[model samples]
Target: MALDRTKDSGNNSSQATGNWKPIGCEEKRAAVHVEMERVNKLPANSSYATHRLRVLNKVLHLISIQRTASQNEELELLFAGISL
Candidate 1:
């Protein structure tokens, strides 16, 4: 009953066999980390995977916005001479 996550096969098709637990947020994040580590193994022009990454990035951005205030003042002071 023990699963070796370090040696996980990375075959998501196995999920349909009902042998896996429901993935929570932390597990989802870990899965993303594993996939990112193997990015070079992926084929090019995978729109589905690209879309998933974009959605994940947006979710992380929203979470950051929720957790912290904008450092607008510091940014303005640092770029005081730069014209936007």
Candidate 2:
């Protein structure tokens, strides 16, 4: 199953080489943990908490789409110099 494969890949990090963590991964993860704690302390039924949850979701979405400068350069090298 797709879910099993996903879990396997996540659990088997040693199989992957190089810089597995994305740029700023630790910082972003720490920020998310802080935000989650803050969110958890908010009243469950409050509109402010709802708003914060939505904002957090958006922030996570943006972070997922973000690429590092080195990744961009690698992509350029892959495409820009190709003669085919």
Candidate 3:
């Protein structure tokens, strides 16, 4: 049944990834390809990724501020004014 599914997908999709174990050269090549793809797709100080990190940081900072604010109303207002 699963073999039929494999054959069906292979027939349909452009890239067919079935359960196949590579032995020597092919395995090494696949590993290299996967590694290269990961490296290439990884962002290096890009705007969108940085934006996401900044958002996460702001959330954590807000959480910290909220925890530490207490009844210090002036400090709470100051922190709240600095929006992300």
Candidate 4:
């Protein structure tokens, strides 16, 4: 009997799910840097600046979480291959 392996192929999640590609830390950081520069150009006390700053802070927090999760996943994979 033959076995099926279509879904087992090493394609990325974007291909399996939809057209959108996953954003990595570099892209996210670049976006944050660009937004920060724009916000800095605005008046210090302006409401829009404050709002953008808040959103940027949240993005930074999420990036931190993503980095931690990726590290944890690597560690888990490493340990998973070890013998007891």
Candidate 5:
């Protein structure tokens, strides 16, 4: 459920479900390379493709954080029960 009410026609909704991890600093640049792997689709060095990949990478990072926080909470609960 992505709500896109903006002047720009292009609106993308990105979300991840299931286990996730923290995306470190290098993840962003590595994402660029991974995106570049699908080179044939885009004209060589297309700026739009580059920007899209960056945006996707950032969204993934955020989603990873969400999953990580949830996992941490679950782990804390488990540990508390064990110590009890």
Candidate 6:
């Protein structure tokens, strides 16, 4: 009633062992820890924390500008010089 193809096929190899942990588990945990530490180190009402927030705002603004620039025609001109 059942078919036994194992004897018909001469190969007897087994699959290799795979990773036990999910991918990027450690990296995600480290990133969360670092963010938590950064948040804990800065006092809510301190001048230093206010200055750091301003700097981070500037950095985010620049990153948004860079992203917009990358989508423009200048990036096409930049890539024009390179040959595949």
Structural similarity to truth (TM-score) of each candidate: 0.33, 0.44, 0.29, 0.52, 0.31, 0.32
lDDT of 1 by residue, 5-80 (tens): 5555668646635576544445545654565445435565887566545644544344334333444333333223
Write model 5 residue lDDT over 20-65, tens digit each, in one string: 4545535544654565466438875888767655555444454356
Instruction: For residues 1-76, write the lDDT of model 2, one tens digit per residue.
Output: 2344334456465444333544364566467657867887999999987876666655555456666787555533
Model 6 clashing residue pairs (backbone): none
In candidate 3, residue 19 scores what lDDT? 49
Greater TM-score among 2 and 6 belongs to: 2
- Tell me the whole-model lDDT of each prediction, alpha carbons only: 0.47, 0.57, 0.45, 0.62, 0.49, 0.44
Ranking by TM-score: 4, 2, 1, 6, 5, 3
Most TM-score-accurate candidate: 4
lDDT of 6 by residue, 1-84 (tens): 765544443333221232244324344335434544575587888886676555444433433454465444443332232211
Q: Where is model 5 poorest over a 10-residue stretch in terms of lDDT?
A: 10-19
Segments in model 1 whose C-alpha atoms lie over 4 Å from true places: 1-41, 67-84
lDDT of 1 at 75: 31
Ranked candidates, highest lDDT first: 4, 2, 5, 1, 3, 6
lDDT by residue (14-61, candidate 3, tens digit) is 335544432443443354445444444658667755554454444345
Per-residue lDDT value at 38 in model 4:
79
Candidate 4 lDDT over 4-70, as tens digits, reads 4445455664465556755566776677778778788999999988977776765656556645777
Model 2 residue 73 CA deviation (Å) reads 19
As a TM-score, model 1 comes out at: 0.33
Better of 3 and 4 by lDDT: 4
Better of 2 and 4 by TM-score: 4
Clashes of each: 0, 0, 0, 0, 0, 0
Give me the overall lDDT of model 5. Answer: 0.49
RMSD of 1: 15.9
